[model samples]
Target: MRLTALGSRLRTTAWPIPFVWTVALGLWGLSREGSVWRDEAATWQVALRSTGEISRMVENVDVVHTLYYLLMHSLFECFGPSTTVLRLPSVLAAAAAAACVAELGRRLSGNLVGLGAGMAFGLIPSVQFYLQEGRPYALVAAAAAVSTLLLVALLQGRRNERGRWIAYACMILVCGLLNWLALLILPAHMVTLAWARPTVRTWIRWASASVAATAGVMPLILFSRTQSGQVSWIPPLTWHMLIGPAILLALAGVGALLDRPGARGLSATAVGLPLLAVPQIGLVGISLFKPLFVDRYVLFSLLGLALMVGVVLGALVEAVGRRSRSSARWVLPVVVAAATVALLPQALAKRSPQSRVDDVLAAAEQVERLKKDGDAVLFVPSARRDTKSVSPHAFTGIQDIALEETPERSGTLKGVEWDAARLRTEMLARQRIILVTDAGDVSKPADSPRDRTKLATLGECFRPVVDEQVRGRRITVYVRSASDSPSRLRCSESSR
Candidate 1:
């Protein structure tokens, strides 16, 4: 009687348990100790722009992230800018996602399953990484979870079918607007409807909702193509990348077998399997043509993995109860506790500044320390100007010698750069220059005429006096004698 009462109370309040748990996890290191990486730097710089400027800038580039930028603009206006303000939305979104996952588990299976899945969602490595990130993916995942819950409710013939369908369409539209790749969830839902063997009416309503959302996002789909070059840096899909998805699919498959599901009726397998497999397979199919197979793009699919894990946990408890009913109740809590212990190191590391690829703020601090007054600053390939854009105060006295126009004025992320001849002319006049670029491990050779000119002119005229690589950025202070000329110092002799 006592255990039953506890279980009933837990089910009644299941959503908050995971909601609070995930929020706590997200806030544990919300600021990453004031470190912001390049990707978040994009968010920071763009979010700080005025709405009109952001609108104009997205017209030329990054239209895909327009809604997110606009949303962040409002948040920045309301909360004054800081790393906490920047990342707190993601934390809240992740918590909402966890709450939705818990409710979905409860509806589809039972209270314990829902609670376990919701709590497990926070512990997943990928979810943990993005929970505190200043990006749109967590929001997309939260929207996906809500839409899936609505779909399940509709499948069960819940009340207010009409209103549920509208809410469902809105969530899907939100996901698509945030990222069109998220439209892949529609097919996953289609598979779930097929598995459930819904009536023709249900199929038609589902199709109508899905099509409406897709149509709403079609304009963005068409417009983003003009800005496709923004993703040109995403490497082609390879066998190495397949390893992670394959392992995930294998684990979900094990959960399906443990589920011992029927061919129909909204089993966890019916929903979870398709959600896990379809989007991954679909991404691979698209990558065949465009090579845009980044896992973060399809992050919503992690909910399916969480669901499958819930199924396994629930089944394990049930089997143990057959032998000893008294023992079954403690199984899940113990497993969760053990998993928490095992993940402690990774959880701590994820909160550290070193977790990201590079810390732009750390690099900015280095530039402040290494710079001399009146030093001319240059960003090789020009995009490295993001370091300066993000922390303009650090370069307060320095001149951007190669910049032709500011990023805002040019409606671009890194702004426009001077022509090659002008860049060379400017370099010749400077006695000392602060050259900022990527670290040696990640740096590529100059790919543009102007960037090549910057490097060549530096190698032939100046010698690197203060060479420091910090946090994935190389800030080299190059000095040249007033009498130095290309003839006096060869590019081969600089050793820079």
Candidate 2:
């Protein structure tokens, strides 16, 4: 009797542990002592821009992220900017998601499984990747996980629990609005409903909630469709993508089969399996038909994988403990410690600028050092002309000679481009010119009409001085000399 009561008390008291760890881990490098990437800088830039500018910019581009941009705008207005202030929302969102993962695991399985699952989620690499990001993804995951937890609660409760059902519906809307991709979880949720043969009233409650969520996001969904070009860069499905989901599901599948008693209903396997499997499989399969296979977009799906893994790990630890009674207590802790050590390198890497592909901070700093007073900058291709958006302080003294309108004035992320004649005039105005372009563009034809105008003029009118490559881009500088000739630098209108 005493042992049984003690077990129950421990389970009740363990709810806060996962949340505490998540917050601590999420805040580790969130202050951004390292470099800030373009995407991170984008959140800062868009939020602080005058509301009207942001409003106008989204009308043509970035319509999908408008809601998130407005939320950050309000946040900046309320709290003066700080690195901590900027990313704290994501930190807290990750923590809440971790906690919810634990709670859901406990509801579906039992105490030990919940603890393991929550810890797995808090430490999982993908979750850690976005935990401190200023973007909407971490919050999207938290909202989706919280909504699923509520669904689990409703399924476990009495059919009369209309309050839980209603809240679940609202949460679905919040999750869906946070990121449209999150709505994919709803179809995976059918697995849970299928597992429970509910009464007519329960069926009615589920249908009503599902309909409200679908209805809530229809307008935004329509708008996002028009902005599909934004994600046109998403590549078609590949072998690596197929291999990744297959591995996650295989581990989760094995765990489901090995789950021991004390785990609650069929809900653990039913909910976790579909949550992990359906989104990845369905998304990839859909990608084969269309092109939407970016892994970061579905980061929340890992929580399902972690939950299932926790149950499996818990069962394994317990089984080993029984088999080796003398060394039982040390076995699980040692195994967990070993796993933690293995994950330490990835966790440490997240603290550096290397966490992102392009270090906008570093690239901007290099530009600041390269150019002198009266020098003009040109962003080739015009589509990536948002360098000033990354480091306004660094670019403040430099001029963008080829830019027709500033990104904010033009109400666009990349800013409006100058026509070839205007660009030639702009280039002629400054003797010292600095050019920045994507590193990937290096191998493109140097003399192509679209590209050669900038470089051709550079070679004819000036002498090459510095050519350097940085984190995500390349920068080159040239200065006018006695050998310069305007006629040779000029391009015909037909070429343009």
Candidate 3:
């Protein structure tokens, strides 16, 4: 009895060590990360604003990320502005998720499976990719994993424990709120529950929990629908979308390497198959019409893949040096370690600014070097202007000609734009105007709205002086044709 009690204590204590290591890895080099990604810049612009402004912004856009923005807002008020402060929540949430994966694995199999699964989750390149982000995807991944853990407890709990069931329902609702996309995991849970074939009362409890969670998430999805244009950038689904599922399947087959057959396989399949399939398949179905597919969107599903692999590896480890297990034991550890090393370079690159669409800091530096006091700036296609959002400090000496109100004042990521005529008038009044644009976008044969306006008016009114290309974009300086100035370029008179 004492030996059993000692074993329990050791197992419990062992849990957090892996959890802490996973978190430390996630948080590594976070402070040194340069040129916040465009998504993180969006967080900075929206979260630092007043609550009323944030509310107004979400009502028109990014309603999908409302809770995450509010959380960042609260953090900003308490800690002031810094990348670390903005992203620490994600780091902690991901750590909690890694730990939850371990705990859930232990419940399904044992400690060996739990430890291997948790470590695999921590080392997944995709997992590390999102954990360091300032956005809500990591939290989404965490919430999804935790909700699954809660479901496991609810399923196994005694009949008298109604409160655990209630907590499980509430947690599913919370996960949906974190990322409505997360609710897709529930269908997978439904499959698991169906496989259990519980008594009528158990079925009722499961039905009640599912209904409550669905009811809670409906309103969020409805509001998010109104702002659906925010994701217009997601191209339609293609064959590439199937690759995530393919990779997961390949990994699952690896776990089968140590399968004990029969009941072991069924149990693992019951837990693992649904997690790997339902969320992804549902998303793919939706993407058939909407193209909402991305690996990060279903990042939670990877935990299931990790758990399945861990179970097999654990079996091999436990049956050490016995018959076929002799070679399997040594091979499993080496394989896992080798897989992690293979992923390290790409994982490390994800930590650097190169992983993002553009280097906002580097572009901001060039703009600083070229601009004179009071120079006017116009960003072609407009959205590329997000570069300034992250380095708001560098544009102090210049003016945003098309910008009518700042992001904070307008309560939007890029701020409100003046009408085209007003923008043209503003541009003509300046001695020198700077153009910020993506290299490909700028070189396109067709003119974007802002591009057309800048070309039509600035073409007739001003002349290009000098232009240079930066990391992922181009910057040009246009000088007024020595004839266009507010004194000489007054709009009301010019129109007449």
Candidate 4:
């Protein structure tokens, strides 16, 4: 009796083990020696900005995920905004997501499937990257998992369960608010329910809840549309990249369908088809315009992929067992164990700490030492530049011109509009300006013609004071020429 009780307890407790592991790994990822990356730095800046300022900032800026910023604002208030503290919420959320994935797998398949999916989730390299950052991706990941589980539950139910319907509604609403990409799951859910032969009342309840949720989320959708207009330079998507996830998803489907036990054909079709098909179709549609087929956007699909693999593998083991009882008994466990062993190395490497925090802090220190109360410090284009080549490799705290203009390339700064006249006014007011640019190697073309003029103008107004090399990158400091006026320049209204 005691042994049976212990077994039951272990079965129940298995779901949370992966969650604990994910959290521990996330914490380790956070402990890595890195400063906040560009997007993370931008999130911190926005969170720190005053509410009044945020309205003005958002009007000109293109930020799709404002709720994440709002949450970060609350976190910053509570924890006082250190990089580690700032990222803790995302790390926690990612860990919770892994737990949810495990639970979903267990409910749909069995304990072995659950364990494999959860461990895979905790160890996935891409998952680790987002978990370590102070961004919305991790929260989006958690919401995606919850939304999927609720969706599966809603479809499987026979009657109108008020609590389940309400839960589904809330999950949908939260998913929409957290990340717009979550809308992709709605059609998948709908198709799954339709195929399940749910009762008429169930359909009505689901429809009503969905419509109500959409109404609630309409304002945010409108805000996203308005914000989209500000980003004019986003390039159209290509066909090859859009179809990539579909192929990966298809592999998962084959694994699931071929491995299922008797009478699983309908269940497999219901879950697998929509999960794989909708994203592929959506990707094709989205690719025709600006490509929204980013890997993280379809993060929810990973759950389906894992489920498909687990079911197929489980079936294979069961099949071998029927042929020979002794062989079958050990076959499944050995396969799973071997798969786990193969995956362990990649998992450990993903969570390693090497974020390069020392670089940004060092640059901040240098700026402090060089700056005086009245001295002007101008980012050449008045935008943040990539500082990856510099020691402690991270983004400098300089603001970017706007999100629309941010470069598609990673580890480089682009899209800052420089106004020479405006720069001159600020410099003259302070009697000197410390001009900083990313080391030339990583600096891309300035975003505006005015930015190029400002670079040329800088040499004319100031003499180089210090040209130091740190971490193989040159950082030059220039002091204003003696002939330049201490008073600020007065420009025409148009110039300003």
Considering lDDT, which of the candidate structures 2 and 4 is the better prediction for this target? Answer: 2
Residue 321, candidate 1: alpha-carbon lDDT: 76
lDDT of each: 0.88, 0.75, 0.74, 0.59
Q: What is the lDDT of residue 105 in candidate 1?
A: 79
Residue 112 Cα positional deviation in candidate 4, in Å, after optimal superposition: 1.4
How would you encode candidate 3's per-residue C-alpha lDDT over 41-75 as one tens digit per residue?
A: 78877777878999988887788788888999999
Q: Which stretches of candidate 3 lie over 4 Å from their true place?
A: 1-10, 158-160, 253-266, 323-336, 441-448, 455-473, 481-496
Q: Estimate each model's TM-score.
A: 0.95, 0.91, 0.88, 0.77
Q: What are the runs in model 1 whose C-alpha is more than 4 Å off? A: 1-6, 260-264, 482-486, 489-496
Compared with the true structure, what per-residue lDDT tens digits does model 1 show for residues 1-496?
Answer: 1234435767777889999999999999888988998899999999999998999899998899999999998998999778998899889998999899888877777777788889899999999999999999999999999999999999988999999999999999999999999999999999999999999999999999999999999999999999899999999988999999999999899888877453248888888888889999999999999989999999999999988888888788777777877898888889888988999999999999888888889889999998889999999868888898889999998999999999999999999988887887788878899999898987998999999999989887888999998878889999984445556643323332
Worst 10 residues of 3 by lDDT: 1-10
- Worst window of 10 by summed lDDT in candidate 1: 487-496
Write model 2 residue lDDT over 421-447, tens digit each, in one string.
677766766778888876763334453
Model 4 regions lying over 4 Å from their true place: 1-10, 59-63, 158-160, 229-233, 259-269, 312-362, 369-374, 385-419, 425-432, 439-442, 461-475, 480-496
Instruction: Judge candidate 1 against the unseen true structure and give its global Cα lDDT, from 0 to 1.
Output: 0.88
